[model samples]
Target: MKRAVIYYSLTGNTMKTAELVAERCGADLIRIDMVKPMPEGFKKQIMYGGMLATFGKKPEITGIPDNITAYDDIILGTPVWASTFAPALRTLFTKKDIGDKVSAVFTLSGSGDNTKCLKKLSKFCPNIKNSVSLSDENNGKPQDNKGLLEDFIKKISY
Candidate 1:
């Protein structure tokens, strides 16, 4: 099955996890780039806007890949901002045509709150088959989570 791992990262943490997931799954990887990057102090900026966006459910993604029909399965990765999925994922969900594709999600955070992001994703992609969350405290190393990611990939029967 054709698969793709797409992610949005303000810091390197989420990008690192996304790369590992793609490599383990032998799937294509796409980094969602904003036309205008967040301000220099992105962490602070995100912390402020992220809360409002999460509460309001407003995603501000400016772009997405034009052709998403090629992938049968998609894995979305993001960093937890204010205990929720990053706004970029929200934007992707609002703008993309992800109908019928098998989907899963992974989140990276200093603490554990996988359920929040997964729950939000469930609302966007109701048919999502699986999801997982990794804590940054576990050494925050991509290699450490390889086995778990590989297992998740194998479970994606699509």
Candidate 2:
């Protein structure tokens, strides 16, 4: 199947995971970004970003891939904030009609409670075929997660 690995990465964690997914699935890779860059400091960025996410605020975004429906499958990736997906994805969900597409989610998280985020994402994209939560202990430089990533790819690729 033709798949698109779409993601947002504030500090390269999601980007690294997206790269691995795209390479493993031989899928087209796309990155959507927040219109306003989040703060660079780790604590401040998390605090602010988590607040925005918690409040269901939709920040503006750019680099949205054209004709996302053209693909057979979509693999969405985001970093976890306050046990939820980033607010930037709120913008994507608002701007796009992805209801009918085959989708899966992969989240890079520190606390390992990405199930909440995954459930939230599934609510937004009802057709989500599978979900994977990965621990990013190295600040987005994930290690020893190839098995988990591959399993997620297999679940949705067919």
Candidate 3:
């Protein structure tokens, strides 16, 4: 079956995870990019990006596929922010109808606590078949979650 790893990343952690998943699953990579990119640095990102995520702001996104039928399995990927998903996902949901898709999911959280964000994420992509939460380690490097990543890939592997 064909697969697609659709994701949004701010600090590149989620992107890194997406890459690994795509490579392992042999899936296509579709990025969620904001029309006006978020600012760099923690303070600015927290103040501006956090606020948008907190408020569930659906900003304009680019580079995502409008249709979801190309892939039989989809892996949803994102970075946890303010106990919720980044605003780009909100925009992605608006642009693509994925409510009926039973997706495999993953999240990259700084504190390694993504329960809140995953709870909120289910509202967009409700039919999750499997999920993995990875904590920030090695300076937001995904390599630290090697074991968990391998397990997740196994469950979602076809």
Candidate 4:
């Protein structure tokens, strides 16, 4: 299948997961960046970034890959914020259409539940074929979740 992994990562955890998933699936990996990037300090990340997520603010984004319609499947990757997918996803969704595509959503969290996150993803990609959540070890590093990622690959792949 022609697949693409579109993702946003603030602290590298989600980026790592995205890389592994893309390599395993032989999918194009595209990273989404907010026009105004978040603060770098830990406290600021929580204060500013978390606040945006908490309020469901979809900040402006740039570098959205073009020609996504050419891919058969789209994998949306995000880092958990306020227990849900990051707000940047909203901006992306507003810019593109995934209605006729087979898609999946994956998240990297710091021991936070992804129930709400998955629900939000469905609003954008109703036909989401699978969802995966990988927890980070508080130190901001993603825990090993190769098995979970592989299963997601199987669910989305032909």
Candidate 5:
């Protein structure tokens, strides 16, 4: 399958995980960048960005491929915010018809709580084949959860 990994990262963890997924799956890497940056600082970020995601607010994003049909399967990744996905991803999904094309979903959660996040994403991406989440300590570092990532990829890609 022609797979693509589309993701957004604020602190590099999601980006690192996305890179690994792309490399291992031999998928295209499409990074989502916001036209305007979010607020800095943890509290500010959680309050501002998190609320935006919670409220289903789509931020202005750049770098979303104009043609999303180039890939047969797509894997989405983002850092968890307010028990949900990033606003940038919300923008992409809202603007694009990515429901049936999504093959899998992955997330980087600092608090290790992503059940609701996964459910919310699954709502928009109904055809997902698999899903996984890595905690703060394990999200970026391959050594921490390589086995888990491999298992996730195997279930979907292989």
Candidate 6:
């Protein structure tokens, strides 16, 4: 099956996981880049200024692939922000009609509740067949947990 792993990463953690997932599944990888990088102190702002933006929904992605329909499977990866999927992903979810495609979501965070994030993503993509989460300990770096990720890819790719 033709599959693709698309993700947005702020601290490189999610990108690392995306690469591994793509390699394991033999899927193409796409990186969602913000036109302007968030300010260096944006994390502080997200905390004090109310994480409303982050937790509310996904933000708009500037350069989404025009031919997303070509892929049979999509694996979305993101970092946990304010206990939810990053704002950028919420934006991507705005585009509907993905019902026939297979989908999965994965998250990487230093510390946060991944269950809530996955649940929220499920709402956006109701057809998601499987989902997974990886903490800082298992993210990016090589480890014995590769088997876990490979299993997830196999589960969703078909």
Overall lDDT per candidate, in order of appearance: 0.71, 0.81, 0.84, 0.80, 0.84, 0.71
Clash numbers, per candidate:
0, 0, 0, 0, 0, 4
Model 4's lDDT to the true fold?
Answer: 0.80
Predicted candidate 2 versus true structure: per-residue lDDT over 39-138, tens digit per residue: 8798899788988989999998998877776787788889998888888877887888764463778888886558788777777888886888887766
Write down the lDDT that model 3 would get.
0.84
- Rate residue 146 of model 5 by lDDT: 62
- Model 6 has an lDDT value of 0.71
Query: Highest TM-score among the candidates is held by which one?
Result: 3
Please give each candidate's TM-score: 0.79, 0.88, 0.91, 0.87, 0.90, 0.78
Q: Superposing every Cα of model 4 onto the true structure, what RMSD results?
A: 2.5
Model 4 residue runs over 4 Å out of place are: 99-102, 138-144
lDDT of 5 by residue, 79-108 (tens): 888888888988888788876798788888
Model 4 C-alpha lDDT per residue in residues 21-116, reported as the tens digit of each score: 888788899888889978878999999988888887879988776777678788888998887778887777777775346378789887735888
Deviation (Å) of 45 in candidate 3: 0.4
lDDT of 3 by residue, 9-121 (tens): 87788999999899988999989888997887889989999899998999988887755666677888888889998798888778777645648889988787788988898
Q: List all candidate RMSDs to the true structure.
A: 3.3, 2.6, 2.3, 2.5, 2.6, 3.6
- True-structure RMSD for candidate 6: 3.6
Backbone clash pairs for candidate 5 read none
